[model samples]
Target: MATLLHIDSSVFPAAGSASRAVAETFRKAWEEQHPEGTVIYRDLATDPVPHLTADAHTAGFADPSAHTPEQAAVFAERLKLIEELEAADAVLIGAPMYNFTIPSTLKAWLDNVILVGRTAGDSPSVKGTPVTVVASRGGSYAPGTPREGYEYVQNYLSAVLGDMLGLEADFIVPELTMAPQVPAMAELVPLFESSRERAHQDATVKAKTLAERLAA
Candidate 1:
């Protein structure tokens, strides 16, 4: 069975909010499809992984052949994140857009995952891994519509990550058509449940097929 990494960058928990609700639906669907698979959850908001420091940044940008003791720790953490991604056949990122961008919490998580030589640009460890990015937004941003200009957030994920991975990228974005004016308590619950359910199921099927190939 493949090991899955579930990254939840929102501040909310499963019990009381829309972002968490969406994340759950996404995770559950994958779990359902890959019952034999394993999942490791990392919630950034509640228990944040530290952001990059000059030390951390230099460590990542540094060459792998030689690392100092302190630098190695930072490098090791990055590799751990990469290992988690590489070990899994797929990845699920639950990130809600904030101000036409992803959350800083999620950004912090990305800062860890996107290592210079490991995941992208020149020295990648794994190629062709499937990734599903679920983005929740308060407003609408569909391609070619009037609101299309607002859709740069998803585009950024695609361009940056796709260039890095050289693989297909699937995005599941749910916009709150009635946000701000309508309380999330009423309008967001269904959307969250449906998206999560679908994502979980999708991953399960993919994992099984990949597992079979690997077993061969």
Candidate 2:
């Protein structure tokens, strides 16, 4: 059976988090289609991965035989994370834009998973994996928006997960998420709601399609 790696990195609670909700829409459909398959769930909000440090960076590049005890520990953790990604037939990541970028927790996970000469670099280990990203932004960042160039989450993910890791990624973005909550964006409430509904629908369709494709 196929395995799916599901990662959630919303600091907000699942109940109100747009990214989490959209990812769940995909996950629910995926589970329905693959009842017997496995799901590896990582809730980064509650179990946050450590941000990349000098030690972690050294551990990733060090030879296993030469790693010190502390470096070995860091290496082992990164190995586990990479192995999970390697083993998965598909991946789902909930990436909520925080401060115009991705959550620190999600960035941490990316740091751990990206291993030079392994997942990336010349001799990349993993490739052709399908990844579905639920990217929820608090404000509008479309091409015509003033903050168009300010959005970094999706572009960063595409570069790392898609170009570097060789994963085929599809993004489901729900923009203007703060419209209802922020008084300054009150006029965009209707647009926000419409975008959210479209995101959920797209998630459902993509999930089912991916499940079927994996099954085939």
Candidate 3:
């Protein structure tokens, strides 16, 4: 059975989070396509993984036999996350914008899983894996927008997940997520709705298409 690694890092739950909501939509579509497939889910907000420590970082480069007890313990925890990514057929991430970048929790997860010669570098273990990221943001950051240059979530992930890790990365962005709640941006609510609708549609289509491709 195909395995999917789904990671959500939004501070809020699905009901209150644009990224989580869209991610859930994709997951539902994926589940429908593969009724018997396995899904390994991690909700970073609720159960955040440990931030990468010096021991964990140093251990990845050192031989396992040389690891001290402290290094061995932390490296073991990091290995579990790396193994999950390696075992997955596909990946889904809800990376909501926080301070114009990905959430710290999501960053921590990435740090744990990324090993220089293993999950990253010239020939990554999970190379060619497809990863769909829901990069929801509070405001518009498209080309010509004032904050366009400030959009770092997709750009950063592209470099890390694609260039460094060799994952095939695709993004579904739901922007202006704060429109409905912010009085000054109330007028953008309509645009937010449209963007959100488009994101959900993209999620469903991508999930089904990916499921079919994996099955093939």
| Most lDDT-accurate candidate | 3
Model 1 alpha-carbon drift over 4 Å, by segment? 63-66, 177-216
Ranking by TM-score: 3, 2, 1
- Tens-digit lDDT string for candidate 1 (94-120): 777777888787776667777666677
Candidate 1 residue 137 Cα shift, in angstroms, is: 0.6
Global Cα RMSD, each model: 4.0, 1.0, 0.5
Whole-model Cα lDDT of every candidate shown, in order: 0.67, 0.92, 0.96
The residue ranges of model 3 lying beyond 4 angstroms of the native Cα positions read: none
TM-score of each: 0.77, 0.97, 0.99
Worst 10 residues of 3 by lDDT: 113-122
Worst 10 residues of 2 by lDDT: 120-129
So what's the TM-score on candidate 1? 0.77
Q: What lDDT tens digits, residue by residue, belong to model 2 across residues 88-148?
A: 9999999999998998889899999999899998766778899999999999888888999
* Candidate 3 structure lDDT: 0.96
